[model samples]
Target: MKSHLIKDVGAKLMNRGHRAILAISGGRLLSAPFGMPTVELHTVGRKSGLPRSCYLTSPVHDGERIVLVASKGGDDRHPDWYRNLQATPDAEIVIEGVTRRVTARTATPAEKAELWPRIVASYRGYADYQKRTERDVPVVICENR
Candidate 1:
């Protein structure tokens, strides 16, 4: 499938209302679609300078912090949101219907080493995603700003 198509479909399925169907509502979370926490990440468009948003799954989260994978479904290229965060790390995230400001940063090699196992444990697809591409899939850590 085309990259844009995958992103479009994913965005649609993960948005607020539809996400409720996947299991999160009014600060309460249940069993999510992939047994992960759902988050709406807001960022500035790197090229357009416009606000952009995408729904993502947090394979690791501790209420105050969130860890995201830039897997792009194992595509060779990084996802737009990942690039956006690289360009502008200041962002906002909404979890369980509550929004908060955050600073986004790519995990260091040591951090990745420690987090990788837990990440894959949360969702086995991450291991598959890493194996499917030659480039190292980055782990993004977002913490309250």
Candidate 2:
């Protein structure tokens, strides 16, 4: 699968708010282009334990080692998912139709500086997103099992 195709299909799914499915499918499409599709992570709320899902892009294998940015479309407040991960680093991820347990953590300042450019280079919108917010965006790294 090609990245452009994944992006196209993903854009369609996202427009319809079918994010989970989109992520699942997109991850498969990313196999050849992006090396492998990232897993779609679903985490339970620390307080409520309710399920929450997000599409993640990884620079590693099957989201086994992944990084997420707290762009939140560059909003002032951090994304809710970021807070959720903070409350509980333990989470679930679905990759290529398989689900697995994983851990999540915020990257250190130095790590973020080193990784941010790579992220921006891969997804240019991130740089644009930064321009919209005043607070620094956080970079989250998810380690999968």
Candidate 3:
């Protein structure tokens, strides 16, 4: 199957919440080296009351929280999944072969100010992405449950 199709299947399986952890663990084993790999984030559709999944890079982590960026590669529009999270802060993240429930919130200005530099240091592409857009990209904190 194509990557997107595979991701969809994985997300659907995860939503069942049965053996999701096992699936995620397997994914981690398969995808690691190239910085934090992509994971399927299962979020609720703001209006549809159904699950939506998207592929996003896993950035740095602090304590129990994982950071994600809504960069969209500096595209003019924000990512759909980011918007969904804004509507409903509760979401599920599959990271490093583990699945966990998390509450998603945008970083506060102070938090962003502090965290953005760290992010750019770890992932240099972020700085280039910033230069491409007029609006500042948001850094989302996914606090684990």
Report per-prediction Cα RMSD to one decimal: 3.2, 7.6, 6.4
Q: What's the TM-score of every candidate structure?
A: 0.82, 0.70, 0.75
Model 2 regions more than 4 Å off: 1-16, 20-38, 59-64
> Model 3: runs farther than 4 Å from truth?
1-30
Q: Report model 2's TM-score to 2 decimal places.
A: 0.70
**lDDT digits (tens) for residues 1-118 of candidate 1:** 5877877576566565555654555445543558886788999999999999877889988867899999988978898899999999999998766798999999999999999999
Please identify which of the two predictions, 1 or 2, would achieve the higher lDDT against the true structure: 1
Tens-place lDDT per residue, model 2, 1-145, is: 4754665566546634546445578644443334435557787776798997766555434335677777766767786678898998898877667777779898899988888888877778788889988998888887865
Candidate maximizing TM-score: 1
lDDT accuracy of residue 11 in candidate 3: 50
lDDT of 2 at 62: 37
Q: List the residue pairs that clash in candidate 3.
A: 24-97, 25-97
TM-score of 3: 0.75
